[model samples]
Every structure is written in structure tokens, then in C-alpha cells.
Target chain A: MSSNSSFPKNEISIIRGKCLVLPGNDIDTDRIIPARFLKCVSFTNLGGQVFADDRSELKGAHPFDQKQNYGASILVVNDNFGCGSSREHAPQALMRWGIRALIGQSFAEIFYSNCLSLGIPCATGSEHLIKDLQKTIEADKSQVWELNLKHENIKSSENTFNLTLETGPLKMLLTGKWDATSQLISQKKNIEKTKKSIPYLSNFDITN
Target chain B: MSKGTLYDKVWDIHRVADLPGGSAQLFIGLHLIHEVTSPQAFAALEEKNLPVICPERTVATVDHIVPTISQKRPFNDPLAEEMLSTLETNCAKHKIKLFGIGSGSQGIVHVIAPELGLTQPGMTIACGDSHTSTHGAFGAIAFGIGTSQVRDVLASQSLAMNKLKVRRIWFDGQLKSGVYAKDLILHVIRSLGVKGGVGYAYEFAGPAIKKLSMEERMTICNMAIEGGARCGYINPDQTTYNYIQGLPHAPNFEDWTKAINWWQTLASDTSAIFDDEVTFDASQIAPTVTWGITPAQGIGINECIPTSESLETNERLLAEEAFSYMDLKPGKLISGIPVDVCFIGSCTNGRLSDLRAAAAVAQGRHVANGIKAFVVPGSERVARAAEKEGIDRIFLEAGFEWREPGCSMCLAMNPDKLIGRQISASSSNRNFKGRQGSAHGRTLLMSPAMVAAAAIEGKVTDVRKMLGSIK
Candidate 1:
């Protein structure tokens, strides 16, 4: 079973095929989903608008408009991926576009967190590795690339790459330990117990 | 034997108790809120039947979802109207100060804080919005919190949190001509990467930082989140005191002297201890732009789109996607890439100064043939100030729409949006895919001047080239 992790994770979804890669830095949220569709309060229904501006600019020739990659999920990108404002919508739009995982050298703090919360895995590697994977895929889109989520590896014919994950967030996502918040919640007893020790925090009934 | 750093001093002063879980029950001196994320928190308060324990310690405003154009009654978006009404009602009910549209004091949460002197040295501030860290520019410890925590603040005026390690980022040398605080921050984020500041509060120090104007400091701290820092701050100095001197919320004459002395004492000692330290050269920074999905994914104006070969394995796929979506080939210079729209406004760069900078460039020129561009002020006051200087006319004449104040197109909570993959040069923060309100809408983040240059060229062009011509 594939684990859902949002923080840059070594465990990646192994897509046993070459995926189309895009190369732009600072590809902002607007290009992922246009503002016109943001009026909807729900992230689930904004799927069609993913890459709204980019799709329109391509005049139906964009890959997002094509039916071939409808459910294709992997997205490889440049450094500072998801930079700009702290809107969680950027990742929400991408997740809806069926982008299950993002491969990039870096990610915006907010965007990366949002992706993690949504079970979307983002991985980071060196610039050289990113470029090699891109060239290999650009030369042969038909070749399947493997992004092994459990193994923390990206396997291509030419090279295999290992990645690092921040321990705190990784543990939370790997075992459905979406329980960190719950742990915080359960700390109510501990909080109360400590209230006696620290009269200031307890004076206000800080416990939830 | 250690001279405490600003972070260390502030953290120690605010630390109420160190709990068993290693988190500190830091005493919050001030908390700010806005309509977007507070409704739910207020509702949570209602559910708990809690009263605002310290209404005087909190401030509220409406920025997000407020239409920049015609912020009239019953906003065009029904939900926005509801949010406004709810915030208005909530503030009234809680006795918390609410800065509504048209109030002279009503501005971006971050902007109003400094301008009114509500943010002061050594205070710990928290807001529901991430950019709340903007207040840290004053040497205050600030954090952006979640909704439940918002409820906690409303109920107790304090939050339970862990102390963060402090990283001292020292910028040496003076910034060169044409370089502004925006460029400096972009440079910092680019060098540190977005996550470099994680688990730390960045104390921006050294000669270069000390010389910056308060507004410039705000801009530097504004993007602290980009560097993955919980907050970025400079010790409050004469510049900070001068900026806050006569504001409505500032300490009056008698209190002013006392406040200044207190503020002076808050500066980090010469021998401050820091968990970590990073250094950068001021001269090395250049006019930067985000070429891909993230703020960290940036390149110098003349740099080329990264090819897969230059990136890591995980980045390869995104690079390929960026190349295709942005319709740029690898190694192609980003400077001449055609842009379809130019947007300026957001908490990031929607102040009066940002508007003037962009307007100066747009004054005698028109937006390029096929480009769509506009300026949205961060607040009503900002819009009015821009109009007072006729910056609005310059933008209008230059083919950019002059919208009212609010967080527009920046996150597309309102009508402004990219229709379909329209490449834009935006001055607002964040360039994540679809961040500007369209799923595939391409966004390039740059300083307001850079956005102006791109608007004129219909592509990403260097602002320095046209700086002289614009003036």
C-alpha cells in the first residue's frame, strides 16, 4: 500500500513509466487554477479548472487538455516549486488535477504543507538528478519511470536516486499517523497535569 | 558569556513555562485577526461558549475576499459579503477593534500594524494568516496559527507552542542601486531555499539590514515564510521608532521616551548566541523572478529555464511540466519570454510604495499589445494614497486597471482570475500553479517594477533597463 506523505518524502509512488516533465520556476497558483473557479468553497469541484490559464493559453493543445493523461499523477518541476503566496489552493488545484506526487528541487513551505495534509507526496533531489530525469523523459516519454514510494527511490534506466525526508512530518504521514493533531488533542490530560506545575498557562484554562 | 540574540531574548521573555512535550507556553502580547480565517475560529469560540478574554489585545480587519473594485454593500460575491458581515458582527460582539474598509486605519493586516505602531519591539504577535510574520520586522516574535489556535487566542490571549531555534542571517555590505528590499528578500530565499528557515526564527542582521527603511524591513520580513522561517526580524532600531513615532496607536510623548528606551534595550547584544548562522552578500542579489511553481524556483532575470539535466530526479518531472506549461524550452533566456498579464497587489507588495514604483514605470508607456495588467492595493488607504499621487491614472493610462483595495488576484478570492494558462507577471506573493486563480495559469513573481517592465514588454524583461526611462 502506498503511504500518503506531504513533506518531501523518500517514499515515492513508482510510476513504472516515463512521465512528461515541465520546467518552469515559480509556476504560481494562478496557472494551476484560474481565479474564476476559486469562488467555489470546495476544493473537490475545482478539478476542471486545474491549469485554467495555461490550458486556455495553449488553445486546446496543452497536455492538460488532452485525454491521454487524464489520471496521470506525477509532476516533475524546477526549484522553488510552489513559490509565491501562502495559498493552499495551489496544491489543492494540482491534487485535483490528479497530480498525486510532485518532483522538484524545492517547494514553498505552505504549498508543501498543504500537499502533505492532502496525502500528496512531494520529493526533492539534486538539480543534476532532476535534469537527468527530465532529459530521459523528454527523449522518451514512453519509457516508464519508477518512483518507489516505500523505498525512497526514483529508478530510471540511467540512474537511481535516493532522497531524504524530514522525520517529524514523515512519521505523521507514513502510517496514517494523521494522529499528530490527535496527539496534541490527547495531551489535554497532560496539559491539565502540567497546569498545576505552571500556574500561568492553567490560569486561562488553556486546555481545549 | 553570551550576548542574547533578539530571538533568544524575546523567546526567554515570553516563555511562560516549558511543558513536558518540549513546547513552551509562550505568552502572546498581541494577536491580530482578519475575516478570512476568523469566522470559523469565532464559531469555535461560540461552540465553546467562550468570551474573548482580551479584546483589547487583538485587532481585526477584512482583506481577503473583499473586492478590490467597488467594495460597496453586498459584495458581488455572496460569500464575501457574508464574511464581511460576520467579521463585522464578530468584532462588534467581541469588542475587538475592527478596521473595516474606508477606515483610514484599515489596511493590510501587516501594513496597518506598523503604520499605526500597534506592532512594537519585543511583542509576540500571532495572526491566522501566514504573512503575519511580517510584523516580526520590528524584532517581535510572530507566528501564523490555525483556526483552533485562533480560538485559543480569543479565549485566553495566549497560545501553547514550542520555542523555535534562532538562525542569524547576516547580510554584509550595502545594496547596490536599483536593488530594493524585495530583491534582497528574493535573494535570501533563493540562496537559503524555501525550507532553510524551518524550525528557526531568522534574525536578519548585519550592516545591510540596519540601513533599510522600516518599509523595506517589512518587505524583508514579509517573505520570511518563503525562507521557511516562522518569522524574520531585525532588532527594533531608530528606523523602527521613527516610523512609529506619531501613529495613532503609538505611545504618546511621555510614554514615547519610556518606549524608546525599552525598545533600545531589546536589541540583540553584540555577543548574541544563535542556534545557527548564515551569511549572504548584498551585492550578489539581482532582480529575481519565479519561473516555475514555487517561490524558491527562481532565476536571475537573464537566466534560462532549467533543463532536466540540471535538476534532481524528483525535480525532473516538474521541470518538464514547467517547460511545457510555460511553453519555454530549456536554456532559453527568461528575460524575453512573453507574458500575457501583469498583476500587482497582495500583502506581499500592494502598499503605496509598491504602487508608486510600478506606476513610475507605467506612467508614459502602455502595457504591451496583448497583455492584461492591473494594480490592486493591499488596503483602501493604500489605494487612496496611490490615487492622491495620481499613480492610479498612470496605471490606467498605461493599460492597467486601477482596482480598489483588497487582496485581489493574489489568491483569486474574488473576480480577478486567469482564464486558461495565461502567463502572468505578478508582483503579489506566491507563484504556485493556479495560485492566481487559474489551475494552469502561469504566474511569475517579481518586484512591482519588474512586473511593470514585463507589462511593457509583454514578457519577462529586466526592470533596470527601463528604470531611467520610466523616471
Candidate 2:
């Protein structure tokens, strides 16, 4: 019952919120945030536009358009969510739309990395567990679910389900190193050394 | 756990340091940026007060949002104009090279880099766009990073990342005539589900791959992300060397020999172990097209869409969703599906070779009445070279509009977009719902030649029949 705490490390370790289940496999980024809306120089107003096309097509019947689903922070989805384009806007739009974490059967590689960059945790579970969670969330949208990174399990009032997260990303998320700019810069010496060692950099002056 | 593969070799060479988390920091050798994704990253760098660590290694281009109809300054779409100008200001302030609009060298980031010889073997490339994997055709490891990683590259010239295993997709036989590289890749994505390449880098090898032209190889690697792999590569060979030998930014004559020597060693060893391997008979693949939204929802031209009973349980949901969204039904053949639009350009199949192949189909045929058709070259160099060969004249005479390049209608960031419920035959990579702009628009993914064939017929026609006639 007490497993959903992130006090010691305290950096994007645990994310708690009402969960919204988007039931579909291979839901792509284009559907999440269409390219037509990507003309802006900033992502500031993307929240209102998240899933605009989908919501419009559904004509207020979409889960996103449902008043009950509003204010949900955890997005529960089926396999391969965020499966197209490397647009961070997809996740940025979702984040702005109030999603802070996601639990899915699987996710696309670039999308997972993008979510990590924004300090949003994407946890994976087995097919059975993910399906069960989606069903559970849809049944009770009012209840809150907690995603505890340190514990590596999602907690609901009724049950605790383990989630799969690679050690590299899990540790980074827990330690607040998911925003990797500073960590990458800390390896400046190593970067310079590797740069010096690259044969092309030294062998030619083919600067574009 | 893959060993001695090109992926392993590149990772070993670029490995900088292992960080606190189990991730390693690898320096990016080449960083490509564009108008749509660079502004926020530049702003982040400014907020952090960090300069571009290696300005010379980064190159910028204005695409995605540029109007193919007319790339005039002060674009009609103010948001787009602001985005492009922001990239220009940022590149100038950061001392980065930008191939702005009308810069003969300016084009899609992926196309321009390869044409200018910035993409080479044994290098690491990073771009904010997913198709950055296109550069992997040169035997380099390329990553499709988000904007924040773009900021990291701008600030430190490096990224903290977990490594990926290598999957060797070996094609045993040659592709059948008219069954192009696009077909082969679409077949690969269909054989292995779109999520199949997750957590792995794909090494495209074997005899069939070895015989492809450099441009053809780029087409395959360009869509690697569509198959879910962030990186895909082929070992550098004479074909690769020939392509890079004398390009504008390629190694000078003095260093060419040395560069070749190093590149040759980057290929996997004879006994190289792979995390996983799959063999496909290229000759067995047919002209492929996606009937559903996802790239993996593809079948041979002669094949019917699978019924729910035929799909994997996990795949059924998306299939149902696709069937509804695309207004397609199960058990219907993908061929002869009427299309409203035919677009023949994108990072996936927008190179000169792609244009030439599509032109051959359009050479003696006019597009079907009432079908809107157009051709957009991949880059400025491609457009000029194609025009020099009078490819543009062939398209224009065939009743297809010949337009400028810039990812037009592929992602539909500009005015070139599908209207409501318009179905498109596209050479671009994705076919997601609303991908081509209109909420109800549908797309069929195929080779550029097939796109040309579809335009001529106003339906999805098999290119093999048209090619057979040409001979």
C-alpha cells in the first residue's frame, strides 16, 4: 500500500493521476498530433490541439472529448503507441493535454526516447496485464493510479502490477538524469577525445 | 549482444563514457536540423547559455513547412515563415551552415546531406526527423532524436543513450523487375510487424541488398523507422565509395584512399554474430501496398486484405480501427482501388533514381481524368538533374503537375494537401490517419513507379504490367 512513494531521489520518480485508457494498437504520432498543426515555432498551444483530427472526426464522442476523461494525467494504451515520426510534439501535446505517464504494451523507439527527454515515463507491461489495466481504467475513471518508478510497479486501489522498464532509462528517470543535456556535457572530455580519434574529422577538411 | 557487425563497430568507435545510469554517452559525428524541429532546441540552448559545441558538424535546412508551390520569402503562412526564419537566425547566430530556400544546395535535410557528401561511411548522424535513418545507407549509425536531444547535440555534440542489439535482415535473391526497393522494404515491414524492430538496429545485408544502387539503398534505409528501428545500415562497398568519391563535401583526393581503407573495415566480419537474423527471398516479394493505416498493414497487389480470423490477436484492434478509418473492408484485393491523388516525392522515394523510375511509367501515358497528380523532387540537385534529363517534361506532358520539393503533401505541412476524404497513392513513408492533412483522407503506400502507374489508371495498378509493356 505504501509502495507508491518517491521521496529519497524525488525526481520524476512517481507519477500519480487519474488514468485514461486509449484502446487501440499502433496508435501513431500523426493521430496524436497531426502535421498540419506543426507549423508553429513553439509547442506552447499544442495542448488544445492534441488529437484534434481524431476528436473532430468522433464529433465529441472521443475519450479526449469526454468530460469524464478530462484532467486525466496517466495515459493507458495498447501496443506501439506513438509509432510514427520523431516529432517530440506528439508527447509534448500529450503532456500539455495533462498526461504525465503512459503504460502500454509497447512503444516505438524514437517516441520512447522523446518521452524520456521530456521526463515522462513510459512503462511497458505484458499483453494480458496491459489489457487488464485498460479495462480497469475504463471501468473506473474516477480512481487514481500511481506509477512508481523506484518500485517498478503500477499501483491501483485493488492490485499491484509490475511494469517492465530497461535499467538504463529507469535509473535515469529516477535520478532526474532523464533530461540528459547536462549529463552529455559532463562527458565533454570524452567527447573531445572521441572527436580527435574520428578518422574523418582528422583525415579530411570536408566541412559542410 | 551482437558482435562484429557494422552497428557494433560504429558504437565502439563513438563510445565516449558510460554514465551513472546504465547508458553510454556517444558523440554525434554529424547533426542535421530543419525548420520544423530546430527552433525550440535553439531556444533551449539559449536558456542554458550554451553554444553549439561543434558548429561545423551541424548543418541546417528549411523543409517540411516550405511551400512547394512557391518558396517565396515572407510565406503566406506566418507560422511557417516564422519557423523558417527562426532556423535562419539560429544557424547564423550559432555559426552553423544553413541551406536556406533557393540555396541550390537547399532541400530536404536527408537528401541534401547525402548529395553534398556530408553523409559517409563509419560516421554517426543525428537529426530531429525520424527519416534521419536515411543516412544509414552509407554504413553509418544514424539516430532520430527528439528536439531536446537536438539541444544536447547543439550544446555538447553528444547524447546519452542505451545501445541497441543488431538484427540482420538478409535478402537472398534479386528483386523482380518493377518490384523496387520500396516494395522490398514494405515487404520487410509487413513480414516483421511494425513493432518488430523495436530495441534493435537492423543491418540490411545479403546479396540482394549488395546489388542495389546507393539511391535505392537510401530508399530502404529511409523507411527503416517505419519498421520501428531507429537505426538501419548497410556495410560500405564500392557502390557506396563510388557515390561519395567526388561529391562536393566528400574527402579530398589526398584522403580518399585512407577513407576507403577505414570504411572497408567497418563491415561485419564473416563470423559476425547477430542478435537475430531473418532471411527473405526478394524475388518472392510482389508489388506491395498498404491497405490500412499502419505501414505493416501491407499485402501483395494480388492479395486480399486479411480477415479478423487471420490476424494476430494483438494486431486485430488496429486492423479494425484501420478498416473503419480507411473505409476499407476485409477480403478485398488491394489492387484497382480507386485513388483521388497521386504524390511522387518524399524522403522515402524522392531521390533522382525514384524520379527517373516514376518518369519511365509516365513517359507515354496520361493520368486518368479527374485524378489530381503531381511530382515533387527530393532536393534541388535532384530537381535540376532530373530536369536536365527532361524528366519534368515527361511528367508535365503526361498530365501530372511538376512541383518543387520539400516534403510536400507527404506530411502536408504546406498547401499541398489532400482535401476531405481524398484517397492518395503516395511514395512517402507513412499512411497514418490524417497524415496527408484532411481528417478523413486515406493513403496507399507504394513505390514511386506504382504511384505513377496509379495516377495513369486512377487506381492502384501493378507496376510490373506497365514495365512489361515498356519493354
> Model 1 chain B — which ten-residue stretch has the worst lDDT?
B16-25
Best by DockQ: 2
Query: Which lDDT values do the candidates have, in the order given?
Result: 0.72, 0.90
lDDT (Cα, 0-100) at A117 in candidate 2: 88
Per-candidate TM-score, first chain only?
Answer: 0.76, 0.91
| lDDT of each residue in A16-76, candidate 2, tens digit only | 8788888888889998999987888888888888999888878998888888787888888
Highest TM-score, which number? 2
Interface RMSD of 1: 7.1
**Cα deviation of B379, candidate 2, in Å:** 0.7
- Candidate 1, overall lDDT? 0.72
lDDT tens digits, residue span B377-425, model 1 = 8776677777888888899888998887777787777778777879888
Q: Which DockQ-derived CAPRI band holds candidate 2? A: medium
Off by over 4 Å in 2: A1-10, A204-208, B469-471
- Label model 1 with its docking quality class: incorrect
- On a 0 to 100 scale, what is the lDDT of residue B365 in model 2? 92
